[model samples]
Target: FNQNRDQITEQLFRLFDLLSITLSLLLSMWLYSTQFSQQYFIAGTLAMLCYLLISSATNIYHLQPGRDINHHSGLVIFSSILTFMILLIAASMTKTTADYSRVTITLWFFLMCLFLIAWRVSFRRIRLNWFKDKRNLKRVAIIGANDIGNQIATSIKENVSFGYQFKGFFDDRKESDERTAKNLAGSIIGSFDDVVHSARNKEIDVLYIALPMAAEQRIITLLDKLSDSAIAVHIIPNFFIYNILHARWHNIGSYQALSIYDTPFYGAGSLLKKIEDMIIAAFILLLIIIPMLLIALAIKLTSPGPVIFKQKRYGINGKELIIYKFRSMTTCDDGRAVKQAEKNDPRITPLGAFLRRTSMDELPQFVNVLQGTMSVVGPRPHAVAHNEEYRRQIGGYMLRHLVKPGITGWAQINGFRGETKELQLMKQRIKYDLDYIRNWSLMWDIKIIIQTIFKGFINKNAY
Candidate 1:
């Protein structure tokens, strides 16, 4: 079943690539007919090449077969935009801009985007339908029935498009007596040796070695025994044992290695983030220039201090950065004795209270985003004094600086925004920050950004 499924998935990918190329060619011909220029054909073909290359670089085509299209749509859109911009730049540099009609190019861009989206949606539907048929699914077994294993099982159950038929778990201990196997319900089939025998007999298609990190010897022994079998193996990293923020692999020279503690913004990720920030910041600045001017005037009239408040905060890599915000207090605090504003704090001006509540005060940070000191979405930067304080109290507070700080973040959207008055609150915020890093994706960033637009700006805890 697994071999058949793999073959089908491979065929589907080949079909997808062929369709993409065909569509690109069709669109190019349409543009040529509309504009009637040789240069336009060249430009369109170059654009298609750019899209394919960037899509590959971003792993858009390398997604797990059963993954939902909606879950990855944001990455698709982002990569598409990156591809479009690269093509546009290339066209401009080659002075081929005049060959393509602006209207036709615009239409082609929208059409290609629609084509890509439709293809992914169709693939998702087809995969889901195949899973429902039950004839093409892979039989999967878990090695351990612990929390991590159960979590994997739950995910497999939820994502039916992955076409994994859970064949139950294998543990050394008795089912009822095993604490780790308890929550797994009835998924346990037999002992570890039984799993080996089943694999040898081609009963299990895939085997997940979900053992805890402490069982290194047991894992090694299991691997030795399973070496003769044909089942695919995967290791579920025990990341829960240590706090990780944006952990990922890095390549130094020709050696690729994992980083237990790291930032997500590196290489293509950094470049993509900067491009996103620049685009967003530029649009925001254009749209809100007048509103910002009015707010500046209001702040100048309502308060005696400067309209913009610049405070010291930790940026990416623990670097000192001057974070900008609309002045919201009678007195600014950037020192060691900084105090968080509470409800009806006397230090907050009347306008400051309103700005803080509505998150209007954060608008100026778009400048920070443009200045390369921050991102449009990431772990929010804390005051340098607060950083100094929390680094001692929280286990991984300093790790938030792994990436550039953002105007809004997962913690902010999840109601961990505003003040961290207690040690527990700070710890909770750090936990979310680290989770964001561990599960970093372009789609996740877009989700957080959308959530922030709808509900994060008006949080009751913002004050």
Candidate 2:
């Protein structure tokens, strides 16, 4: 049987999006006191064609793993922008730019993107609350007792709005086998025979075959048995589960390559990240320029060093970047054996203590953000000495360098700012940093920036 579940979901998204596009264009027409014209109709048709192709290619309308509300909104806006640009390019090529009203095109672009995001959010909220229908809810079962199977179960359990009710797993392995389930929902309730019986009885709506490739014959046998039930079944490939952090497919001359330890900031993702950093950094730099200048002057008068201390730190892809901050210490330690600043350390001047406590010392780093050496929200770059030392001792420590360093970060906001003297503390900080890299979005960055404004600054841990 085909996947009626995903088919129905995709149809709903596709239909609603087309309707939104049509309505947005009509509104734009009404706004400009213009009636429908051939040019307008042509533009609209081309936009819809571009959207369908791009959206389908990117799998935008489908529910996927690791796609949160922000992720959905980002993809929708991205697809809409591409559609708008394609239409503009087509118009330019046909030398028909003068045929359509610029005002109408501008209004349509704005309204289309806005309406697309708004309608999806509104639909999600209403579907979850106002409708309260449970017809689409499916009872799912996994045929494997492995890591990927358990991960799938966890995803289903967590995304309650997806309307999946996991009905435990099915495995033939004995209790002593290493493949037995661990800490998963419901645990192994039955074997393959039981799963088939339940499927035939109409108790199981969806079946996920997460068996290893080595069990090809066993999988074929199971598939043959489940063929009679008419229940939808899908296979969970082991390769896709090998690494989940920033995992995405790349096409190289018609070949698919999976990057295990890769950065998310590539191609359009890189542009989006830079745009986010630039806009936020510019706004912040304007607001704090005066305060940063005052802090720089204070450091100059109090400390016997440069007002702006630049130290070597690892940036994106482990590139050495000169990170900027107001010199809050009496000495500038940029050497191989830089010391971690400690509370009441003699190296810290009186003014430096207040600056660090209030996080005014980091104000200068906003300039670094504007200069593209850093980001407004990312993993904070450690001292070159700290980075080198921890890379050897801490697992996945160097992975934090996958993104540009930042003035404020998930780690800093979660009280990992200031000196991490203990190895365990540094490990915890790196963990949060990696987490941020794994699930970064513009909305996530904005959330961190807002959190930083309220409570991230003036942390008790800050020296």
TM-scores, one per candidate: 0.68, 0.56
Best by TM-score: 1
Q: Which ten residues in a row have the lowest lDDT in candidate 1?
A: 239-248
Best by lDDT: 2
Q: How does model 2 fare in lDDT?
A: 0.81
lDDT of 2 by residue, 1-463 (tens): 2468778978888988888889999999999988798989988888888888777765677666334566567667767877888888888999999888889889998898888889878877875663245566788899988778988898888876756778888988754576586676557879877988999999989999999888999999999989898798998876435454357788899799876667778889899999988887788788878887787777777667788888899898899988777888888899699888888889888998988899888887877887898988889888898889999999888988888888889898778998777898998898899778877777667657656765678888788
Give candidates' CA RMSD values in order.
6.5, 8.2
**Model 1 Cα displacement at 417 (Å)?**
7.1
